[model samples]
Target: MKKETFSRVFPFALFMLFIGLEEFARFLQGKDILQVGTHAIYWIYPVKAVAVGAVLIFFRKHYREMRLGDLGRPTQTVASLLVGLGVFWLWVNMDWSFGTQGAPSGFNPNVFDDTSRTGMTAVRLAGAVLVVPVMEELFWRSFLLRYIIDGKFSRVPIGTFSWASFLATVVLFGLEHNYFLAGMMAGAAFNLLLYYTRSISQCILAHAVANLALGIYVLQTGQWRFW
Candidate 1:
């Protein structure tokens, strides 16, 4: 169990560092070390994406044990997709204008850089839709969700539920995003999905579905704040 725990944990801890890495880039931009516009984002997303890739590679064996191939039943996939979309709907409406501090600004490809606007937007969207969901699911749902419930989390079974683990994951997951309230709502939904399906693959698929919708919505509406 210790070996298995290590197998699941090490990569996830490293993966979470992407948030800090981006914040560091933002700090550099703040200090005038890096340009505010595209220059900062250009380095941020790609580096994080690369880091996610590296973690996957480093833990390839254990990652495989994660049973990514065992995505979920067809019914589970369909239901999760709908849930994902529902979360997106709730997310867009749950802004801070009511009272809360607004979510931190998300990636904005248009005003941020100029060299290759179209290409940069493509990369940004791709990373958000493709890369972010996979990495986050692996760390959050596949590992942290159970790990928080037990030391030998792997034996705990997927969809294992304890109020402590569920709420802890929900709050922490919510805090990860800029939109505190909406993120909290989304976290709740995703956590429920894991509970319902007991499949990391389904959780990943659901998250990917949400991100894809969000990417498209952000692009079409020019709501860069959601990026």
Candidate 2:
């Protein structure tokens, strides 16, 4: 194969490998295989971030580099604002969906109990703000959506929207979360960011900001039901 073809395929293959390894490890360990919550934020989350960063570095020539400044587009700003409102509206609409479980009976409130000595809360916060945004944006926005349009990802326009790719990814993303509605909204918003700014970094930043705000709100309001 040509060097360009190899470059295009390698990062995506590595991403799939990383995801499979993480999931298989989790299955074998019967819990979070990385033990992310047990380790300090500086140690665990940063290591995961480094792994993602390394992949980007290795594929720097093939992959597009996105930066925060790229998000200055008016459409991107509007989309980001709409994302926030959409999430809040989804929360309100799904209030009954959460039910009245409460505490340890049906749901464990300790997950959001930041006062606890366990590092789970911190780990979750770090993952949301740092790790998740990078990996997810790379996969969902930069790779899968473009890959759906054509094999040559670099040549594919960033804002290209395919109904098939959007729905498929949104469903997959939703299944990853306990709050299905919230996850669906998140997936849509991230895709919209890519569509508006034509920058994966903008989607990454928007995702991180949304998750960080949601995390803080969950802690403050004792809305562990969302978790």
Candidate 3:
């Protein structure tokens, strides 16, 4: 692919690759390939965060669509924040039977004792609220959404809408989450926000807010499944 495409896709791809590796490690444990005492699978989160976070930082300058100035308007900024809070509310409540099943062990940092748990949880939370929003917006919104509108994605205007791109992004984004319905709701909300403000930074702000709220909720309620 082109350099622009690589810059946008690589971090997201690397993040997913680590996720795949985590699952593979779980599978191997289930099959007795790795003894329970020897398995350091939980470390995968920090490692994944650092690796993908580094890539995102390296390509930060390439993300022209993520201009922080784009979010300068008060009305749009408030709207994005409200939409994010609304999506977070919907997300926690939408854990219905139809949603994908939660992982059998949902990122429990408590597996390690106090200090380690706190450290791991902090890393995970940072990854979710910080790195993830930027990475996902770059991939799901800045790249794929526009790419679906045209192969020459850089040529397409930011937030340019089409039924095919909108619907495809909505469905695929939903599938990316365990809470499929909530994911779809969040995807639609973000997509609409993009259309309204034509700003990737706005979507990132919304996403970060949603994740921050979810992280607080999980910590408060010990709802590891939501993390």
Candidate 4:
């Protein structure tokens, strides 16, 4: 991998590891990672979440080479945001049988719990809203998408298209999520935004909008499974 690819990917790799850490923490304590942990969430999440914070700080300005400027032209920005909303609506409706089975019904903050005890739900909402989009955008669109076209990814233009590479990236992106179908569609939408606007930041904004809506919906309806 190129230096830029490595840099862009490192933080995201840490994030993936952090997910495992969450599971490990829960497993070690005999608690369910998916459920609202009355006490387990307090120490396990905050402590491990610090590692993610550190990784974020380390890569704060690392993707400078990508030039993800101005979040695309005005038209692209509006379109991407609209597409994001559309993705959110579609995401909730489609649950592929091959994808994840819904989580066992569990405690959701709005209904069975609140932010008072652990504040984990609130923290997760913040992450979904703020950090996740930025991290995934740079890794998947700016780096991986272009990286697939060429190892010297920076040489590949932001919007460069290759059918095989694009589809592969979409599949990989889809596999990353619990809902394969929706995730693939979401990936395609974000990838299209990158292709159209030629702006990594636009993809970032689009992803943020989608996740923000998902977070809001999850919080409002006590959809702990989605969280």
What TM-score, over all chains together, does every model reach? 0.85, 0.64, 0.96, 0.83
Q: What is the lDDT of residue 178 in candidate 2?
A: 55
For candidate 2, lDDT tens digit of each residue in 1-227?
A: 55545554455456556545544554545555445532222233334545655665676666454666776777776676667556655654555555322221112335334554246566557766776666677767777778778877668877789898888777766655556666776787778767777788777777777777777777787775554
Candidate 4, 58-79: lDDT as tens digits: 7676676345456546788798
Report residue 187 deviation for candidate 4 (angstroms).
Answer: 0.7
Residue-by-residue lDDT tens digits, candidate 1, 33-66: 9767645555666666666666666766775435
Q: Quick one: best TM-score, which candidate?
A: 3
Per-residue lDDT tens digits for candidate 3, residues 1-227, read: 88899999999999989988888888889899977642289888899999999999898889888888978899999999998999999999988877765553667666788988899899989999989999999999999999999999999999999999999999999988878878988999999999999999999999999999999999999988886
TM-score for predicted model 2 compared with the true structure: 0.64
What C-alpha lDDT do the candidate models reach, one value each?
Answer: 0.74, 0.62, 0.89, 0.74
How far off is residue 5 in model 1, in Å? Answer: 3.8
| TM-score sort, best first | 3, 1, 4, 2
Model 1 CA lDDT for position 173: 82
Clashing pairs in 4: none
Query: lDDT for model 3, on a 0 to 1 scale?
Result: 0.89
> Could you tell me which 10 consecutive residues in candidate 3 have the lowest summed lDDT?
101-110
The all-Cα superposition gives candidate 2 an RMSD in Å to the true structure of 6.0
Model 1 spans > 4 angstroms off? 1-3, 10-12, 31-38, 64-72, 98-103, 112-115
